[model samples]
Target: MEALKDYLPHSVEGKNILITGGTTGIGRATALLLARLGANVMITGLDEQHLKDALKDLYKEAKGEVYDVIADLSTEEGVNATFRTADSHFDKLDILINNAALPAGKVENGSYSEWQRVINTNLLAYTACTAQALERMKGDGHIVNIGSMSADVREETGSIYVATKSGIQGFSEALRKEVNKSGIKVTLIEPGAVDTDMQDQPTQEKKEKVENLEMLTADDIAISVLYCLSQPKRCDVVELKVRPHLQII
Candidate 1:
């Protein structure tokens, strides 16, 4: 049971994977995780320096093929160009991880600009990227959306981030029905507060404060991605939510 808990027939040794927002957080974590599993990983983000650093980290972890495409996922043109660049190299994408996301940054006193930026980057960008991705992927492809607890529970606030995240959940549900016959699976990964920059400065004390709990790590999320990809094509992994035990209501 232990060996088969995450044991599936599919392997990432030669699969072509495209991860958006691959510079930081879960996206970066997935890139390294997939690379280590022998997949040819391609990442996209706006930060050139960060991208370079992530590639280096990927090599250190996997020592294999890792490609980086520079593009802001916030705009239609950027999303389109990213797909074009990736398609030029790989004809089909076995896995597409829409992990690229931005935080809602202090919504209490935030203005409309902040809300719009969050919506554009986190919500619209994901839709645009997925559109271009579907055009290239044919059969048995996998799509994983890095969703949030805010989407399921009360929207975090400001209605900007919350609305966008809610869209991800809705899209995943609709996409599953639409693509069921197409052999493509759409899954939503809703995780609780991570010990990353997304939660602001998540220090050791803060991490320790939550006892009897399992704080979700980037690697943990990446492992979930790997697990889903490892499953047999006939099997489907739908919505999965990870919350630490100490996360009090």
Candidate 2:
């Protein structure tokens, strides 16, 4: 097991970071890791109670400023509110982790409204947030998009989810080419199934399969984020894919 201290470093010290959906899963794990490493981090989530609880955990090890805002990233107002709140906390943004996403089970099984919600949350919000971050980042910044292997290894009943992940893969690539000249680095992290609350709603049999498969933990993805941030400004990790050794496709 890799300890949190092992991931800490002076490279990210005093850097201002903003992570969406930071109350849980990869976002929360990354927030905690960066906070421990001496970066001033502001995280946004939709749940107030979750935000409070995540803050409690963050305060325990955060060496730099830790702030959070409760805001939905699906709506324009929510997106604006998040950046407004972040701006008040930090003068300049060094990193933007677009980790907020909604998983959709099936295309045919869901209604149009449900489809819209999933697309807005998973795809549109990421681009909108990136645009906002680019404005605030000036000429130098790092944008890490948390994508999924589902984009490539598609499965039946996962059409909607796969569509969004696929969009992220393409978006990250095009955006990277557009921004790299400005000294901004863009990274896309595609990971196989991870053990998180996101998996709690699956069927018992499905959950059993995941448990047996030895899924990647939230910290595993966080370490990937840290690795991207730790690189020197002259170097950029364009895309990183991770999967549990036992995970098939």
Candidate 3:
């Protein structure tokens, strides 16, 4: 694979971006990259300490302004607060990265509350945030939805997670068509097993498989986000599916 620096472009300079779940993993990685590329960035997360620590790191390397909002996307109030924070931080938004998500075990193993948590964070929040962003965006804007390859592979214990991703795919498609005439572009990124805190609870067999296959890193997916945003306004990258070469599914 080519180095991420090789794909870096200056198209993102001066852009204002908001990323969900930016305290860690793919969202954090993307926020850092966009900051370095001169985009004003605001990230939202539920943890106060994590958000503070992430801001320190972001400010250290960011060429543009960096901000963080503490909000849990699982609730409607939290989702609304995030956009309010973004509006206060940036003059206008150029990109919205819907990367916040929660993983659930099996359908039968999880309770109604657990199912609602995953669904709200993974699927509902994405739509809600996009709607608010659309209202704030002027003529042109980009919406990047971070999905999962599980939507296609559909693992046995990933029913809830896969369902949310499938919904993301459908939502991205319909939203793209609905807003394309207004100069807003929608892109969905589906990534396979990424090495992040999200995988900390994997089973022994799953861990071994990830180690053997050499799973993709959070930065890998972040680079894909840059590529999507770097595209010309006339050309929209509809969907990008990235996976490790050794990954079977």
Query: For residues 112-191, could you state the per-residue lDDT of candidate 1 as single tens digits?
Result: 87777677788888778777777777867888999988886765453566778889999889988988788888888988
lDDT of 1: 0.79
Cα displacement (Å) at residue 214, model 1: 5.9
lDDT of 2: 0.90
The worst-scoring run of ten residues by lDDT in candidate 2 lies at 1-10
Q: Model 2, residue 186: what's the lDDT? A: 99
User: Model 1 compared with the native: what TM-score?
Assistant: 0.90
lDDT of 2 by residue, 172-213 (tens): 999999999998899999998787777655656545655676
How would you encode candidate 3's per-residue C-alpha lDDT over 1-249 as one tens digit per residue?
545553456778888999999998899999999999898999999888888888988999999998888998999999989988888888789999999988777897979998998999999999999999998889889999999998888898878888999999999999999999999999999999887777855666555666687588788899999999987677789999999879766
Runs in model 2 deviating more than 4 A are 1-8, 201-213
- lDDT, model 2, position 13: 93
Error of 1 at 54 (Å): 0.7
Q: After superposition, how far is residue 226 of candidate 1 from its true place, in Å?
A: 1.3
Instruction: Tell me which residue pairs clash in candidate 3.
Output: none
Give the Cα lDDT of each candidate: 0.79, 0.90, 0.89
Each model's backbone clash number? 0, 0, 0
